[model samples]
Target chain A: MKEMFLIIIFIVASLLGYRVIKEVPSLLHTPLMSGTNAISGVTILGSLVSTAYAVSSGSKFLGFIAVVLATVNLVGGFVVTDRMLKMFKS
Target chain B: MIGTYEIVSIVLSILVLVGIKLMSSPKTAVQGNRIGAMAMLAAVIVVLAYNGIIDVPLLWFAIFVGGVTGYIMAMRVKMIQMPQMVALLNGLGGGASALVALVEIFERYKQMTLFGRLTGQLALAVGAVTFSGSLIAAAKLDRRISQRPIILKNHGLISNAVLLIIILLIITASVANISGIGFIAIITAFLALAYGVLFAIRVGGADMPITISLLNSFSGLAGAICGFTIEDPLLVAVGAIVGASGLILTQIMCGAMNRSLVDILSGSQLNSGINKKET
Candidate 1:
């Protein structure tokens, strides 16, 4: 089933990521957290699709809120991660 | 199952994955982040164009407002406050995913098959938990709430009981086609939200980073479930990558702190004052 396939991919991805992240130093933990937050903002795509297809005013309103919240997550996450990384370099 | 647009979207999402992987390294992190963001933008545009929705002024306006808020906060917040900010962003992401699932459920719950309804419920429960839980984590990090493990007498028992109730309600809501089931589902959601707050607040400050990462993974899982509800493979891929990245970060953090995930979750040092405030 599709769900099972996705679950399998999830495990593989987690193991692969763990292999990579384990090499990172403790000094970068904050930046790593912020950076992953930025990537998770990818949910914005789903919000956009939902907002477009929403028919009723209520659904549209929820979709709109979702869009805005997701945008905040995406933009803020990236900018903050950048700032944190900048600190590391300087 | 295979369309040009889907192929393009999948390819772009893979780039996002590659970007995130690159970000684990210090030398290319910023560029990697930019690559990921660009891929998201590209995928969004492709999906929008394919769906034939080119002009939605309200959507653009919402994005503009959100962009300004995010820009200002990211620029103004101090470095020490990054953890709380990350937690807040994670909460927002989770809340957004839940809202999407709720909208879909409201629009089509009556027509959806059991599988569809189950996916919706999964999205709703996980999303609500991540949203509220991440906020509590942020609050603790910001010192708005006590940073120590907040152990109410019989806390574990209460959480377990509530979780059992939620499971029962979710099953009923998913199987029964009555209006009352909707109400039950709503109450279940709020209870799950409260549980999220309780779960996060019980951890000590020293473990806040791991909690944030774990919550990030929860939000990603919520998003993936939301994708299944909407039948979007791109969303699934993006969510999986974020979820995996969060889990990896959490493991690394736990290892660095010399604690296991189980220890952090169980409030291992709850009343003994073993984890003194880290200055």
Candidate 2:
């Protein structure tokens, strides 16, 4: 039953994601990526909470890895983005 | 029934619709609005699947964050700065998804059955790559690094060789079920990160929108693979949504730029100079 739940998520999210991406025109790609980037950032906090809640031994280990990866992705991407935005300033 | 990425889809729809109707074209905005609605519906389905019913806490948290962020960015964040903010958020999401996969990887390793290790390793590689690649691409888009392509002359050869070698090592250890497989596998993880950065550095600014989209897809795919490996339904659904969205974005961005995915990947053609040409 739980597995079915996972499979459903797997199928639906991919499909929705596909539609969302497909419908946009190429000219709007920058705005779309930028909007989604912000959206994806919110996932970090959610993942963090999930990681923090992980109690099983295996889950704990994986949780720690998740924290680290999320940190790098968040920090590195933001820093790069900040840098990129600065280009327009000059 | 909602997630950050889904919220973005929704807001993006609003922005496009409002911005376009007010400024551009209603037809285009209508098209975008439909897509946004689809993304929301998709998020809901996964939310239902993973939790059975939307857990109250998750719902409140997601909605509140969405509301607050939406308000703050809309009211306070300038239109010009909106792009950078979006880039930041997307990078964060990709990062978070990758982490979810990592958690699965770490948890599974100690007690991995033979096949478990194979799935686990694949999850890690993909997750690690997404984490690093997305970051680099974000940097390029954000203009933190040079908007110009940062490729080293022989970058393609070096990156490919390294990736292949990492795969070789993973296959050997997982097949042999060797004692030091874990430690060896960790090295490949770092190597993947390095390759991700190098690959993005060479991609020019003009290509960043597409690059970010592709990386976003990678992140989603990583999460899906992780969910599959750990048998986590919610993660798989959410991950799939992200992966699919990323791919679609990549295609759209590619079309707008009038380039093929192949050219974008090669990193030779995508340069910052082109960004100044036109939208």
Candidate 3:
């Protein structure tokens, strides 16, 4: 039952995302990609939860690394996108 | 029945959607990015509180180090380096997903349901591929590697064989006993990494935009699949949205290049006589 609910959320989100992203002008494609790229860092949530729950030391270490990498992807992606968008402003 | 966590997650997902919606115009793009970042911050806080991990100093430290590094890299990168920077970040995201899935497999394989096992293995494979593929794409774009397509003899045959092996390994790992699952998962990651390199190495420089976009989508799909393994609604929804956004961008890039996604993936366009003039 939970899996099905998640599947539905995935489908609905994808459809809406396609519709919304389609409206972005071609000129902003780079920023658009970078912005969405940052959003993919959503995995950090998974990393944090998994790391906290991790039983083994190795698993905890891996999860820690995952957290760091995901955070970097998130922060770097958004900042870069913002920089690019600022270029257009000036 | 839905709980408070679910409700909050839904609201946060909506906020993220609105953030993306605001990116359609230049005037609102910076604001949109800020909103997206704010939503991400909130999501992290909520997840930490809900999971009762808010006090984990190590996790906080990890975030601090990663945040500082990411900000410095973003500020230092030149405009001409944007594509590779994005590619590098995509690789990191995918690598993180792969690691999370791998750890999950190690930590919970015995207790996990069949569905969890399957999704976990799939996430590992996709994430591994995205990680390596994006790195290669980044290197190529940055001229760290040859920009020309590195088409080895029977490249298509080799890539197909590696993919088939990955599928078989995923299935095997999903059903394997706990004692053997870890080994199988490691082999699967290695093979998937190889496939990623092979897949990205054959695309010429002219096809990089589409390649990067497609890998961007894979990173999201990897995260979404990881969400299923871990049963997180917010991760699933946000990952799917990112996946869809990347797909849209890939489609736009393909259209702009007058090339089909299939051609780019299969490397057929690289060898076609008529298309040779454009590249």
Candidate 4:
């Protein structure tokens, strides 16, 4: 039941995302890619939860690394996209 | 009845969608990026609170360090290097997803259902592949590696064999005992990494945009699969959205290049006489 729900969510989200992203112009594809790249850091939520529940020190360490990596991807991606968008504005 | 976490996750996902919707125009793109960042911040906070990990100093420290490093890197990177920078960050994101899936497979192995086990292993493979593929793409884009296609003899056969082995490993890991599962997972990751390298190394500079976009999609798909293992609705939805966005970009790139995705993926375009003439 839960898996089915998740699958539906995935399908719906994908359809909506395709529609929304299609509206972006070719000129903005780079920034668009970077923006979506930042969003992919959504994995940070999973990393945090899993790390919190982790039992072994090794797992915790791995989780910590996951957090750091996701953070870098998120922050760096958004900032870079912002910078690029700003260039267009100027 | 819907729980607080469910409500929050749904609302946040909507906000993220709105953020992306705002990105369609250059005038609103900066604001869109800010909104996306803000939504991410809120999601992180909610996860911490919901999981009661809000006070975990180690997590916070890691975030702080990563945040500082990412900011610095973003500020220092030249505009010419944007493609590589995005590729590098995509690699990191995929790497992180692989790590999370790795830890989760071990942490929940004993308690996990068959579905959980399968999804966990799949995520690990996808994430690992995305990580290595994006890194190679980034290196190629940055000119650290030769921009020419590095096709070995019978490259297609080798990649197909590796992919087959990965599928077998995933199936084996799904049913294996906990002790054996760990070893299987490690081997699977190594193979997936190899596959990623093999897959990316054959694409010349001309097809990098498509390669990057495909890898980007893989990263999101990795995260979405990881979400299934953990049963997180927000992660599943947001990751799917990202995956879809990447796929759309890949399609656009393919159209722009006047090549089929299959031609690009199979490396047929690289050696085609038509390609040379067109270029």
Candidate 5:
């Protein structure tokens, strides 16, 4: 039942998110993408928390994986975002 | 001895260094984007290799699965759909955090200690709220529902009051090891989700990037709370990284957009005077 609820949550959220983001115009995508990249980077903190909460030694391994994925997303996203914005500057 | 997040971080760092070295030398923006993604993937690859758990055949199979999916999506999807993809994926992060919290709640149920009970409830509440709230925000942004403002006067003030009352009650009851109020905590989550949606809808389309960013931060905080509830040091650290970075990004987004956090939260044009008037 718990797993079912979690699945439901993801499905609903995904559908809704898809709808909302679709409304954004294509011309604005670059700026929106750059901006949301920062938003997506929130995954870093999520990874950290999950990593920190890992109770078992085995869980630590998984936690570390999550943290690394998130950190990459955060830093890489930011640098790329800055570069993208710079294109608009010239 | 090894896991995904650590490897991803190291790979990302190396990519950053390589990127810096190449910076002044000049490159196409498209090339930069491609390299950045490769950096992310490179980290993912290292973690998988370092773990050394999956067999060779499985590793090849996993890569094939992910690659095929990405290729198909890229080939078929319209460029216009990218933002929706962003929202959908970000929603996954938020929803995932909430689910982790749910598991932690069950863990506490088994032990039922003092701080365990309090932290458990808090984690659960935050998770539930993020799960629903992120959904609503994404829905509003995607225009899946009517984009019109669903206005209620004094919403922020009322929400603050109600949430405060609930917290006080919970804090008082927490010492007694109250187990039954978990349902109320769940209800609070429903309210948070609803209010967050309503809040997101009231803001103009121009404001959404920050809204999405802020919600992303909220998800991180939820994960952090989950980490605490589970008593895992690594989870806590990772969660904190998400929470802090999300917060920093939110601040940067707000600065770029010239909106104050307070205005974004309590003073939506439709919400009508939650704060006292200056005059």
Candidate 6:
């Protein structure tokens, strides 16, 4: 079933991510957190869809708000992460 | 047979996973971030282009305004405040997912099957909790709230009681097939929202990074549920990636603090801050 497949992938991905994140140095924790934060902005796609196809004005408004919030999270997260990374590069 | 659109979505999703994996390394992190961002943008564009939705201009305008606001905030915020800002952004992401899920359920309440309804409920509850919990975490990091644990008398009993009530209401609403916007659902939302604040308030500053990471995982899980309700595989894949990564980060953070998840959640270390102060 599709659900079972997703569950399997979830387990595998978690293990892989653990291995990957374990390599990050302590000094870069802040940047790593911020980088992941940007990635979490995947909600923007959902917001956009809801806003564009809303059945009612209330839903439309809610969707609009979602789009804005997700966008802010997306843009801000990336920029902040970049700034933090710059510190280590130098 | 799978169509071109599905093929494209799958490819883009794989790229995103790759980007996240690459990001874990310091040397390729920046490029990995860029790759991830581009994949997200591509996903958005693909969805928008394929779906024949109207009023596209308005959506673009709104995105523009949000981008400007985010750019300004990220630029102005100092490095020391990065953690707080990340918390705020995580909270916003969760809030956005919750709002979209709520809107979807509201518009299609009658058409949803039991599975869809359950997904909706999971997304709603988890999203609301993540939103409020992350905000409280941000406030604590920002020093707007106390960094010490805010434990109430009989805290364990009280919190358990509230959680029990919440689970009961959710089950009742689901079994009874009550509409999402109905009174029971509203009360459940309210309770869940309060639980988020209470949960974060009790976590001390020393354990904040782990708390934030855990909340991030919740938010990502919510997004995955939302994706399932709407049958969006890209969302599911992306959400899973984020959820998995967040969980890993939470574990690493807990290891750093030399504590277990249960120990942190139980508030057993509430007075650890006081002990440090005395030392």
Which of the numbered candidates is closest to the native, going by highest lDDT? Answer: 3
lDDT of 2 by residue, B1-279 (tens): 355644543453343223222211223433333343344344444443444444535334444554454444435545555454454455445545555545544444566665556656666677667667767765666678887777786888998987898698668756775666546667867887787787778777777767767877776676666666665444455556556666776776666666777666667564533453333
Native-interface RMSD of candidate 1: 1.9
List, residue by residue over B1-279, the lDDT tens digit for candidate 1: 557965785687668777776777888888887887788778767767777775878778878888898989899998889899999999999999888888878777888777678888878888899999999999999999988889888999988988888788778778888676557657877988988977887888878889999999888888877877777777776787778778888888877777777778767663343354331
Candidate order by lDDT, decreasing, is 3, 4, 1, 6, 2, 5
In candidate 1 the C-alpha lDDT for residue B69 amounts to 89
Candidate 4: give its CA RMSD in angstroms.
Answer: 2.0
lDDT of 3 at A10: 87
lDDT of 2 at A28: 46
Give candidate 5's whole-model lDDT: 0.47
**C-alpha RMSD in Å of predicted model 6 compared with the true structure:** 3.2
At residue B95, give the lDDT of candidate 2.
49
> Which residue ranges in model 2 land beyond 4 Å of their true spot?
A1-28, A34-90, B1-78, B270-279
lDDT of 5 by residue, B52-158 (tens): 53354433443454345434543453434444434444554555454444444433454655555566566555544554555665566677855544556876676
Worst 10 residues of 3 chain A by lDDT: A17-26
Where is the poorest 10-residue window by lDDT in model 3 chain B? Answer: B270-279
Give DockQ: model 6.
Answer: 0.60
Per-residue lDDT of A1-90 in model 1, one digit per residue for the tens?
Answer: 666655554565455544545476787777777877777777777788878888899889989999899889989998998888788788
Query: Candidate 5 vs. truth: CA RMSD?
Result: 10.7
Question: After best superposition, candidate 4 residue B170: deviation in angstroms?
Answer: 0.8
DockQ of 1: 0.63
Q: Write the per-residue lDDT of candidate 3 for residues A1-90, one digit (tens) a residue.
A: 998988898899888777776665778777888888999999999999999999999999999999999999999999999999989888
Candidate 4 chain B lowest-lDDT run of ten = B270-279
